[model samples]
Each structure stands twice: as structure tokens, then as C-alpha cells.
Target: MQPGQQPQPSGSYYPQQAEQYAVPPMIVPSQMPMMMPGQQYGQPPNVPQHMLRHGYIAATFGTYGETAYCAFLKCGLGQIPLMFSIPGCTGAYTVAQSVLPHLPYGWRAADGAPVILLDCIIDQTRGPVVPQEVWMPNSPRVYDQHVVRAVLRPPTFFVHTDGSVGLPLPQILSGNFAVNNANAPVDVGRSSIHLHIKIHGYTDRKRQFQTQESGQWIQLRRLVGHVGRAVDKYLREAEPDPEQPVPRLRIGAGGIVPADVVVVGVVHVSSGSWMPILQLTRALA
Candidate 1:
């Protein structure tokens, strides 16, 4: 599937002859409002409607320059910092990846693309202060101050299961398990299921935040790392007995065996950290 596209069943975990399911409509860029820098949008009391949709304030850098542009998003848990830097005269810029957990699940655009808030601050004086490079040789910059909608791809999941059936890790983690029955008649009685999941392409860059202890910069790797470790520990604690053999099903009066026992074993895959990036662009006003 393409980046940011919804997952399709592979029949690896579903029962055969299962019917196809419909995914919810994706959020498109046109559905969101466009605003310029310093323009006032949102309800009274200083709350934006888009922020209400995701239950958190979204912020983006409205200005750019040759050296670097920095901004922050105020997630309820913590502040997510973003930095975009241009090293050389090639005009190429690298955006700092922002990481936050529990973002509204399945919040995509009307075109089935993922939707991320591009915070547009109209007040140039009040918005994020763009650091100026005085002695820099290359002065690359973008002067437009407007909001635009953009797209971003989603992450990939690698699932390891030791049981009578294989299941998609994303669906299971997202609590959408109905698709598991699309392949064959799933025998829910089998209790030997243990799942090990690894996610890829979540975060591309290391992020940092200020701490109370003398305002030191610290990497945000723990957010993703803690989750992986917690999941691993949970699966290990729930592991089934190693010596038990998988039970076989017998059919017909002659006791003929038509299907082999589906005993799956979990294979160890490399684990790593992930922090997803939100691709943004200037939407036409």
C-alpha cells in the first residue's frame, strides 16, 4: 500500500472466504480551514476548532530562513520541538521530526491522506522567533506566511504470533479485530496466541526538549523505547507453555484429517524507536 494508505488484509490472520470490510473516509485538505500568519481563527476563549478535533494544540513554523527555523507543538503530555535547517546553498532543508503519543487514531484527510495541523501564527512579533544567522554565507529563506494542507505516510508493522492463527498487528493494536475472520472460520477457543509487534517508520529524526535541571537538552527516544519495552514485557509474561503440542482437529466418521494443526512460532525481529513526521505545505487561501 502507498504511504498514508489504510491497511488491507493479507489473509495471513483471517479465515478464508471472509467478506471485505470498508474503511472509514479519510480527511482531506479541503475539509480544513486555511489561515495566514497572525490571522485570528477559532472559537472564543482562544480555542481552535481543529485543535478540538485532535484534543491538542498543533503548532508549525510559519517563517523560514537560511540558517534554521524552530517551532513547538504543545501536546498535553509535553512540548514537541521542531527545527528546519539549511546547511548549504543548495536550498535543501531538513525538518526536525516531532514525536507525540496517542494522537487521534485514524485522523486522515478526505482523500484518505493523514491530516496534521500546520500552526499558522499571524502576528509576526508574537509567533515563534526565527533565529537569525548574521555571519552566514548562504541566506536561503521563504517569505510566505500562510497555511497549507499536506500529506504524510503512515507507519508499518511487523507482527510475530505463536498460535493457531496469524493476525495483523496494526489491526489488533488499533482494536479492530473483526477483519481476522476474513480468511477462514476462526476458532476463537485456541488460547495459545502470543503476539510480538515491531513498528517501523514512526519517527525519522531525534527530538529534544528542555528540562528543569538547568535547561539541558535531552533526546526524546524514551517515548518510543518505553512502549516497545512495555509491549515486549507483556508478551513475555503471557507466553504459553513451550512443551505443549498443538491440538489437531478430526473430521468425518473415519476420523480423517483434512487440515494440519496450525501451530505458529514467534520469530525474534530487531526492535527500534519510531517518531512519525508531519509533512506540511502552504495551502492556497
Candidate 2:
């Protein structure tokens, strides 16, 4: 093979092709190959043109699109280590090839499914031509500052009808998050969100609060962006703006609330219609 010349297909090419790969539109690192030490920025020949490289993927869906290892994630319930696969290619690099994200414990119910926000860090610096597959499937944009991201299964891309997430990609997530109410009639676009998240059983300091002297705008910084729009890019472009409300994790003057009380909220996407807005509510039974 020569520079810019595509390599021959591997035996599993059909399976690979059948397995659709989508890079979320969120913050992604440059797909341009990162040069090895002592090599000129664009010079060739650190290795053989015929040399092949291997990469890995942890996915919710699989060959033939059966939601293979992510069976439990279908209804947004259950827990298990994510499924991953490793394969070789003529030009690519792999880091944390065995990485897998675990679902948070105890989030299943009937009234609704808990919205799980996801993200990850993807670096594709070793491929010369194509982006070497550092992606988070369902996240919104591709910012180097923002980690890579994704969702359980498309379930229609699992994105809101309004496109709140920005772009679509398959997901395995990371980062702090929040949610929208599942039973809402519409987007329920709330301007403010306050969540009493379960930190830990022993966490004595709960309920975030700002000093009386602080302005409401100043308080917005303490709270993370809405997790329902957890993967959206608008939150990252600039400093926190109070107008775009976020989930405030307050520390009450009375101290921490009991951890046994589980609170979970999510923006729901069903067959077609979607309600992506969120508000604080008790965990569904």
C-alpha cells in the first residue's frame, strides 16, 4: 500500500460494515494522525505503509444491529459492564482499548425510565487519513474540552424531537448530568432546574446554597448544566449564563438529606414524539 491508498478489507469486513459506527457531533479530538517523536509534522516513513493498526469499541448495539450486549439498556434499566470489541486496521491507534462504562445502580421503574447522561474522551491522533475512531455516540457536539459521548440505542437516536443534543452518535457516557420529566406533554423547557441528587449515604453536606450576598447569576456557576440536555454543546461554548438554567445541587442550611431517598428525572424519547425537558421529582415506582 502507499500513502493515501486504502488497504485491503479484513475478513470480518462484512461484519464491520454491518456494524454501523457514528461519531457524536460533540467535542472530538482531531482525527489527523499524531506524529511520532522526531518525525516532521507532515513527513512520512516512521513506519511501513503496509503496517496495520488495531482499535477497539465498547458498544450498545452490535453486528446485525441487535442491541447485543446492551439488552438491559433497552428500557433504560439494569446494570452490567459495557461490551467491547478489538480489531486491526492498516492505519489506526488504540488507547484504553478495554474501556467500558457501568450503569448507575438502582434506576429502574414503571412510571418512567431514568435518563442517563453519557460522555467520554476520544483521541484519534494516530491515523493519517480518517479519524481513528475516538467517539461518544449520542453526545451533541465535538469539543476537545468536552469528553466524547453517546446513548443506549437510537430508540430513534434516543435524542429529543427538538434536537437538544445537537448531533447524533452511538453512546457510552461520562461527565456530571441531570434530567427532564418523562411524563411531560411537550418539551417542558424549564428555565430553572434544581435536583436533590443522591451523592452517597454518608454525605452529610447536601442541598447546595449560595451566600445571601451572591447574585442569582453568580449562583448559576455552581450548578452543572442540565443533564437532560447533558450532552448539548450550547453549555460549553461560553461561560455559564443564568438565562440558560442548570441543575443546582444545593447544600441546605439544615445539612444533608437522607441518601435512601432516590430521585431520578429524564427527558423521554419514545417511538416518535419526545419530551426533553426536566424538573426535580421523586424516583418512579
Candidate 3:
């Protein structure tokens, strides 16, 4: 067929005026023609142009919608192996032909579910994407630098209503900031300035929620803006004590916190509000 020239239909061609006909039986995987090296599996050479145009490819080869398989392909991995095993089956042929092109390089299905790749582990309990360590055979220096950077950085905290905090930002951002009161609340009167302010709710009037059901944590950069507003509200409500030096909160153009204060933890209230706890230290002279 010429490039972009629509192929004409042959054999039992149903014109627009033809009466409805019975649907054909589905072709099993074994009955489908073997895919040539350069040919796309679904678009087999033997299949009629009309059948391929009507999505017979998917119907004949089965669905290509496996989660892990799709994710593996999205990461730019090549074709799935033909000899691997799948759960409840002995060989790869049991899997749909369409899904075969998307499976991870060496991974297989387990209990009819996608097996996690070693370089990208999925946390089943938390249902959150967790970072995995990747090894680079040829780039040792780059890998070492990445490891050092990851280790030195502190985890982002999510403050709960009861003045407790959760570590690592991902869970909190995903709306899992439930209250954990084990950790003590920061003492505001300590020698070092530790700013602990309860985030009651959004300052935006239109987005306000009940005090009991507030505190879903967003990105830390956005949270800093809310913190600024909270501090302003506190300053307006209370009288200025002469002995206490005003705590200065400075965020750089790129949202880097000044050295004086470090974010410690985020507390989620029973009512679903989030509070941020910051530990303040003397800035370098």
C-alpha cells in the first residue's frame, strides 16, 4: 500500500446501509501470526488493513495495560523477554503479546501482580513512591556524590495537630499526615529560638476549612508562605515583650531558609490540620 493511501476493504464489505451482523469470535494468541523482527506485534502483516484499522490489533493480541509493564516501558527499557515466567504460568507466552513489549527487563509477574524492580522498589504498605539506590558501574564519582548529598540532607517534616512530626516529605504531601504525639513539642522559651506555630488553616478565605478538618500539607516552599502569614497573625494578636528579640524569618529568592531556623517536624491534628515546627539557632555573625 502507498504511504498514507487509505486501503480499500475486501470480502464481506458492509456498506453504511447494510444491516447489523454478528460479531466474530476472538482469535487466540496461538492462532495469531508470529511477529517479524521489524514488524510491530499488533500490526501483523497478515492481518487485513480494515481489521487493523478497526483495532483488531488489540482484540487479537490482548490488552497492553499492565501497570508495572507500562512503567518499565515508560522508563525507556527495551522489549520484554520471551522466555521469562509469570505467576500461575510456566512461560512468557501466557502473557498477552501486547503486554510482552512493556514488561521490565528481567522482572516477572508475582501472584498475578507486577514484580517490583530492584532499582525501583515500591512500598506496598504506604502506597507511596519511595526512592531506590541506583548503581553506576562506569560513573563511581557521580554515584558517590549522589549518595553523599542524599545522606547529608535532612528529611522534610510534617507537623501534626498534637505537636508531633513525621519524617520524609512524600507521605505528608500525599495526605497521610496523621497525628503522632510521641515527640515532644518544641519549647518556645528555650535558649535557642524554636518557632512552633500551629497552622490553623489556609489564609485564603475561599479555601478555608473547619478547624477540626484542616492541615493537609502541600510543598514546603508553599508552606513557608503560609508560615509567614501565621507569624504575622501572631505578631498582631500579642503584645511585644521587651526582653524577647523579634524572630526574623528570611527566605531566599529560591526559597532557601536562612541558617537561623531549620525545619524540624510537621504535626497533623486529629481534625486534619498541619502544624510546622522550626528549630531556631543563632545565625553566624
Q: Write the per-residue lDDT of candidate 3 for residues 1-285, one digit (tens) a residue.
A: 333333232312211222222212233333344444467756534222212222221221122111112222222122222223343222122222233332322224655444422111111122111111111112434423322211111112333344332233333234344433323232111122122342111111112222211333233434433444444443234333343233122233332123223233322211122333333232222
- Model 2 C-alpha RMSD vs. true structure (Å) is 20.9
The C-alpha stretches of model 2 lying farther than 4 A from their native spots are 1-80, 84-158, 162-285
Model 3 whole-model lDDT (C-alpha atoms): 0.27
Candidate 2 is scored at a TM of: 0.17
**Any idea what lDDT model 1 has?**
0.21
Best first by TM-score, ranked: 3, 2, 1
Candidate 1 structure quality by residue, lDDT tens digits, 1-285: 233433322222211222222211222234434443355656232223223222101221111110011111212211232221122111111112314232221123334433322222221112111111111111122111110111111221111222112222233344443321122221111111122221111111222222122332211122222233334333333222233232111122232111111111121111111222111121211
Best by TM-score: 3
Cα lDDT, model 1, residue 261: 11
Worst 10 residues of 2 by lDDT: 48-57
Q: Write the per-residue lDDT of candidate 2 for residues 159-267, one digit (tens) a residue.
A: 2223122111111123222222222222211223222211111121112222123222212112222332332321122233243243122222232122211111122
The number of clashing residue pairs in model 1 is: 23
Model 1 spans > 4 angstroms off:
1-25, 34-49, 52-272, 278-285
> lDDT of model 1 at residue 74?
19
